[model samples]
Target: MENRWFAYLIPPFIVTLLLVAGSQFVFIQNSFYQDLGLGRTGTDLTLVNYIKFFTDSFYLKTFWITIKVSAIAALLTLFLGFPIAYVVARMKSRLAMFLLAGIVVSTFVTIVIKVFGLIIIFSADGVINKTLLNLGLIERAYSIIGTQEGVVIGLMHFTIGFSVLLLYSVVVTVPPSLEYAAQIHGASRLRVYQRVIIPLCAPGFVVGGLMIFNMCMGAFTSAALLGGGRVLTLPVLVQRTVMMEVKYSTAASIAFVLLVSVILINLFSLIAIRRLRSARLVVA
Candidate 1:
C-alpha cells in the first residue's frame, strides 16, 4: 500500500515501453529497404513499397474487406453471445458448469475441423443439398463453399464461445436483487435484460468485442481454409505478399498498420467502457 500510485501504472508502463521499442526496432530495420522482386535487397532506399500499398486498388480493396469482416464478426459474436450469457448467468446449478465446459471445449475446436464439419453438412450433395433435392425445395445443389457467407459463418462459430463465457462471468456478478426489484416494478423479462443486465455486462462485452475484432482482422487460417482463398482479407493479402514476392518490408508495413489499428480499437473500447461506468455511477 505504500506505493499505491506506483502500483497503479508501472506494470503497463513497462510493457508499453518494451512493446514500442521492439516494434520500432523491427519496423525501422525492415521498412526502409526495397523489395527487389524477390526481396534480394535493392541498391537504394525507396518509399515505393509503402506508396504502392496506398495507391494500389487491390490492397485498398483488401483493407475494406478486412474491416467489413471484422465488423460483422464482432457484431455476430455480440448477438449470439449475449443471450447464452444471460441464461448461463441467471441459471444457477451444475448445468451451468456443464454448459460453460461445453463452450470452453467448443472454443478451441480447430477451424479446419469446423470447416470440414460444415462441408459435410452444407456442401454440394451434402445434407442440406440432398434434403432440399429430395423435398423439391431447390432444383440444384447450392454452392456455399469458398464464399463470403462461408467465411462469416465460420468466424461466428470461431468467436462466439469466448464472448459468451466472458459476458457470462460479468453477468453472473450482477446482483440478483436488482433484477428482482425491476420485475416488482412491472418490468418485463426482456425489458429487465435490455435495461439492467446489458449495461452491467457492457464492460465484458467491450473486452470480448475487441478480442473478436482483432482476431477476425488477422484471421488467416480460418478464412484461408474455409473460404478457400476466395475471400481476400488483409491477413490473407499479407501472407500472399510475403509468399509471392518474398517482400518482408511490404509485409511488415501492412502488419504494422494492422497492429496499430487493432491497438486503436482496443483503446477505443476501453474508453467506451469508462464512459459507460461513469453513466452507471451517475444513475446510482
Candidate 2:
C-alpha cells in the first residue's frame, strides 16, 4: 500500500517539472536569437541582445537598482520581523496562535488591495502627510510614489509576514532552556539573544534572507504600483521590453540575466557563509 501511494506522486511531479522547468528552458533558449521587433526573431542565433544589455547604461542601471531595492528590502524585513517573531515564539498563552493566524491571513491578502492601501496612506492629502503637516513636521507633503524608497517599502510590506513566519519557526526550534541557562549565568537579556539565540539561528537567517531577496527580485505588482513608473526594476523592464517594445528576444535575454544573477548571488552567499562557519569552528 505504501509503495502504491508513493507511485501516485510521480505523475504530478513529472507534470510540474514539464510546466515549470520546461517553460523556463524554452524561454531562456529564445534569448540566443536576435530580436527583429514586433514579436519577431532573427533565424540566426546571436548574442546581440545580451551584448546590448551589458553595453547599455540604462539596462545596467536598472539591473543594479533591482538588486539594490531587493537587498535593502530583504535586510529590513529580517530586522523588523525578528522581534515580532521572537515575541510570538516565546509567548505562553493561546494569543500566540491568534497572532500567527492574523499574520498568515494578512500575508495572503491580494497585493492590489495592499498597494492601494499604501497609496491612500501616502498620498499628499492622506493620513500620514496630513498628520505631519498639522504637526508642522514639514513645509510640504512628501510622497513615496515613483521613488526607490517607495519600492523598498512596498517590498518590505510584501515580505514582512513571510519573514516573521520563517523566523518564528527558527526561533521555536531553539530550546527555551538554553535561554534560561544563559540568563542564570549572569548574562543580560540582550546578551542572551546575542550570544545564545542569534548564533544558533544564523543558518536560518541566511536561508530566510535569500528567500525574501528572491521574492523581492521577482516581485512585479508592488514595484509597479509603488514605483509609479519612475523606478524601473529588471522585471518591470522585461515587461516593457516584451509588451511595449515588442522585443521578445530582448525581454528573454533580460529575464535570463536576472535569473543568472540571482542564482550567482545565492551561490556566493552560501559559499561565504560556509567559509565563515568553517573558520569559526577552527577557532573554537
Candidate 3:
C-alpha cells in the first residue's frame, strides 16, 4: 500500500518537473539566441546577451541595487520580526491570538492593494511627512517615493508579517524549562536570551531571511509603484524590456541571471547555517 501511494505521487511530480523545468529550459535557450530588432530573434546561438550583462555598467548597477536592497530588507525584517514573534508566541492572552490573526490576514491581501496603500502613505503630503513636519523634524515635505529607500520600506512591509509568523512557530517550540534553568543560574535577561534563545532560533532566522530575500529579489509590483521610474530592480527592468522595448531575448537573459543568483545565494545561506548549527552542537 505504501508503494502504491508512492506510485500515485509519480505522475504529479513528473508533470510539475516538466512544467517548471521545461519553461526554465526554454528561457535559457531563448537567452542564447541573438535579438534581431522588431520582435525578431536570430536562430543561431550567441553569447551576446550574457556578454552585455557583464560588460555594461547600467545592467551591473541594477543587479547591485537589487542585491543591496534585498539584503538590507531581509536583515531588517528578521530583526524587527523576532521580538514580535517571541512575545506573541509566549503570551496566552486573547491579544496574542488577535495579533496572530491580524498577521495571517495581512498575508492574504493582494500585493497590488498593499503596494497602492504604501504609495499613498509615502506620497509628498502623506502622513509620515505631515507628522514629521508637525513635529518640526523637517522644513519641507519629504517623499521617499521614486527612491531605493521607498522600495526597501515597501518590501519590508510585505515580508515582516511572514517573518513574524515563521519565527513564532520556532519560538514556541523552545523548551521553557531551558530558559528557566538559565535564569536559575543567575543569568540576566539579556544574557539568557543572547546565550540561549538566539542560537536556537537560528533556523527560523535562516528560513525567514531566505524567503524575504528571495521575494525582494524578484519583486516587481513594489518596484514599479514605489520606484516611480527612479528605482531599477531586475524585475522592473525585465518587465519594461519585454513589454515596452520588445526585447524578449535580453529579458530572458536578465531573468536567467536573477534565477541563478537567487539559487546561489540560498545555497550559500544553507551551507553557512549548517556549519553554524554544527558548531553550536559541539559547544553544547
Best by TM-score: 2
Candidate 3's error at 29, in angstroms? 0.8
lDDT string for model 3 (73-143, tens) is: 99999999999999999897899989999999997798889988887886778888889899999999878
What is candidate 2's local distance difference test score?
0.94
TM-score of 1: 0.83
lDDT of each: 0.80, 0.94, 0.89
Instruction: Give the candidate number with the greatest lDDT.
Output: 2
Off by over 4 Å in 3: 1-18, 281-284
lDDT of 2 by residue, 1-284 (tens): 99999999999999999999999988888899988999988889899999999999999999999999999999999999999999999999999999999999999999889989999999999999999999999889999999999999999999999999999999999999999999999999999988999998888889999999999999999999999889999998899888899998899999999999999999999888889888893111
Q: Tell me the TM-score of model 3.
A: 0.93
Which is superior by lDDT, 2 or 3?
Answer: 2
Q: Relative to the unseen true structure, what is the Cα RMSD of model 3? A: 2.0
Off by over 4 Å in 1: 1-24, 43-45, 134-137, 272-284
Worst 10 residues of 2 by lDDT: 275-284
